[model samples]
Target: MTTQEKRNLIKGLIFISPWIAGFLGFMLYPVVASFYYSLCEYNTLKPALFIGLWNYIDLLTDDIFWKSLWNTVYFALFALPLGQVVAIALAVLLNQRCVGRPIFRAIYFLPSLVPLVALAVIWLWIFNGEYGVLNHFLGWLRLKGPNWLGSTTWSKPALIIASLWTVGGAMIIYLASLQDVPRDLYESAELDGASGWHKFLYITLPLISPIIYFNVIIGVITTLQIFAVPYVMTGGGPARSTLFYTMYLYNNAFSFLRMGYASAMAWIMFVIILGATVIITRVSKSRVYYAGE
Candidate 1:
């Protein structure tokens, strides 16, 4: 190679060296090691004994595994779309010029800045069954409130509702993308006698579709890995209504010391996320447009 080409190659490797090192040391090794572990029966004290596909087979018949998967799917199904809509709405509202807009945006984003554990604790207080703020307010209005964390029926919804409080981070991203949309498009639409909603439908939505796609992917991945809130607030209680996939994985790895089983579950999760992301990207290409493309 020429000296200039060698210099470019060296610079490229220098820039990527940290990522390459970290991936090998932290990610690649663990993933490969985990696959081997998944083929064995491992407990912390005992050496892993090769058990072939027994772990995978057992997972198929395991009630807890199925229940955890269902619960996670439920959480994601409800939380992802609901959170995205609310976040986008908040972003749209905040994008407008109004008095104290910055303050309002800050208020909306405040919940996201709170530590996860602290937010969970505060939500626990709000979701408390007997003397909780939510129930008390309902009582004053003479409306009956369902037992949220205490009942199987309401527990998942309560978790979903609590999660909505943190949609501000997503809203901020959407707002930033919304600002980049060309102002002349709206002006041109108005000159052509398009209604406000029509302009939004034709111009604004198309321009922001790329960000929307990104948020959907991010939201799915994050929601699938949900652990802390449900763990802290519900403990997978009320008959495991809130038991997420990650929670189950944690229990098997640490509480039950079934590291091999946990490794299998981790791989399963990775596969699910990867498949969903691929499907979404493929489907979105028709709608999502890049400016220069």
Candidate 2:
């Protein structure tokens, strides 16, 4: 390389050296160690005994693993799409020429700023079986509400409902992307005597597909790694209805002291997430449009 090119490369490396050091020191070692540990049977105090694919085989026969996977899949299936719809609808509404729009945006986004523990606490009360706001309101209308977290039938749905309260961060991103869209597209659609629905269909939807794709991928990743809310509230209770993948993994690792098994589970989760992300990103490329790409 030329002297100037070499100098530029050196400057870039110097700037990124901290990140490189951290990645190698922390992330890389743990990732490789986990894969190796997954093949062993270790309980922290005991020496790691290499057991080949036994851990993998055990997971195949494991009921809790499957149950937790199902719970997590259910969470992702409903939460991802529902949260997207709510965020998008709110974004579209906020995009309107309404009075106090800034205040409205702030109000909508405030919930996302609340700590996850606080959010879970508030939701616990909201979904409480008796003497709770939701149940009390239902009682006022002479309607009986189910014991949400206490009942297997309603626990997962209640958790999903609780998760929707923090769609504000995604909504903000979508709103910004919406604002970046070209106005001429809408103007031209109007000149064609297109109704609002028609304009949104032919103009807005196409333009915003990229942002939607972005949000969906993020939502999927976050939903899969979900641990805090269910951990705090249900403790994976009501017949394991809310026993999510991460919670199960946690139990295996710390509670059960199955470090090797937990490592295997973590690797499996990594593979599943990596595969899903790859598929989504590949599929989205055809549908998502960059404004001036």
Candidate 3:
């Protein structure tokens, strides 16, 4: 290479060196360490003893492991799609031109801006069975409100309901996507004497397909890793009905001093999340609309 070319290459490398170093040190090292730890038996105080696949094998026989896995699956199944759909619906409403629209959007978004722990605490009071607003309102209608966070049958659903509060972030994304839909397409549809429902079904839905795909992947990952709200609200109580996979992993690693086991669980969750993402992306190929496609 010429002298100028060599100097330019060095300068470019120097510009990006900090990012390269950070990725290797913080991201790559931990991923490598965790994978190695997942194959051993280690507590923080002692050396990691090689245990082969025993941790994975033991997970199959442990009831709590299965229960936490089940709870996680239950939470993800409902929370993922429900949150996405609600966010999309809100975005559709918010995208319409109306008086006080910005104020309405801000009001809807305020709940998500609250700290998650504080939000969970507030919802705990709101979901309180005896004197809570929800139950009190139900009583005004001469109806009974179930013991939400206090019942195994209802705790998971309560958490799912609480999950909706954070839909603002997703709604903003959907609203942006909605705005990007071409006005000419809607005009052309109108020329064909299309009704609002027909226009939305044929045009808005297809054009927003890519955004839906993106939000679905995000929702799946977020719901799968859900921890803080349920942790603060129920602490995996009500007969362990809210025992999320991450909460159980935290208990194993920190509370029980089973670092290696927790590492194994983390890797398993990583595989599950990666598999789901791949499946979603592959499925999206047939349905998601892009300008190029």
Candidate 4:
């Protein structure tokens, strides 16, 4: 309304103009164009031809698309919850006053720092059917190991097991949250004759619930979009049991040149992620505890 205010606003906008330009050029434009292209038949080799909602309709009837979706959902159902439990359990253990605590924490976390491709490659060898370390150990107890990557029955499970190796990042987050819980609360619980399990359920969990909710929401998004490991390790092989939604989308976009179909799939995935996040938030409303709330 005033000259000084207008001048300040212009200066602020000028300072942020680079960021504004980057957002429009790199982020907003691509999203808008992707949505438009999703409604059309697009391949890099030719001009896009508008085809309305045919892409979406085709996706609905596509068997492979449904299979990929099912695989992704199946992976998420098992991976997300199990990852959370393992991470929380590790965090709780590491939070205790014990010898070699720092070393143990680092040992647990180092796996997550490995590159995804490298991690996949390493696990590929580890899960090898014959002459593999895992099978060698299993044989010591007279138990036979399944052909992990080769068997359709074991491929998804193998990927899931490989996924658990990278739970270190989540573990660190939970460990931090655990450390932030007031020590006096645990002491008071102990004075009340509360067992370790009781304290964990009643005191520790409630205090760290907000962090759990945060991790669960993040885990949902990440697990649903899992691509790199399965892509490198299984290559969606052994009857497509390990085929995930993102891998299928990648194939459509790059491998098959079905960009329009891929775009439609991407948008659908976006909706799924958004819906899952909203559902999680709604469900957490009664459960997640916030300090001083």
Higher-TM-score candidate among 2 and 4? Answer: 4
TM-score of 1: 0.93
| Candidate 3 whole-model C-alpha lDDT, 0 to 1 | 0.93
Model 2 agreement with the true structure over 1-293: per-residue lDDT tens digits: 99999999999999999999999989999899889989999888999999999999999999999999999999999999999999989999999998999999999999999999888999999998887798999899999999999998999999998999999999999899889879998888889899999887878888999889889989989999999988988899988999999999999999999999999999999899999999999998898888789
TM-score of 2: 0.94
Candidate 4 local lDDT, 1-293, one digit each (tens) = 79999999999999999999999999999999999999999997999999999999999999999999999999999999999999999999999899999999999999999999999999999999996788888999999999989998998888888899999999999999998899999899899999999999999999999999999999999999999999999899989999999999999999999999999999999999999999999999999999988
Alpha carbon lDDT of residue 123, candidate 2? 91
Q: After superposition, how far is residue 93 of candidate 1 from its true place, in Å?
A: 0.3
How far is 81's C-alpha from truth in model 3 (Å)? 1.1
| Ranked candidates, highest TM-score first | 4, 3, 2, 1
The estimated TM-scores of all candidates read 0.93, 0.94, 0.96, 0.98
Error of 4 at 252 (Å): 0.4
Residue pairs with backbone atoms closer than 3 Å in model 1 (clashes): none
| RMSD, one per candidate, in order | 2.1, 1.9, 1.4, 0.9
Best by lDDT: 4
- What lDDT does each candidate get? 0.93, 0.93, 0.93, 0.95
User: What is the C-alpha local distance difference test score of candidate 2?
Assistant: 0.93
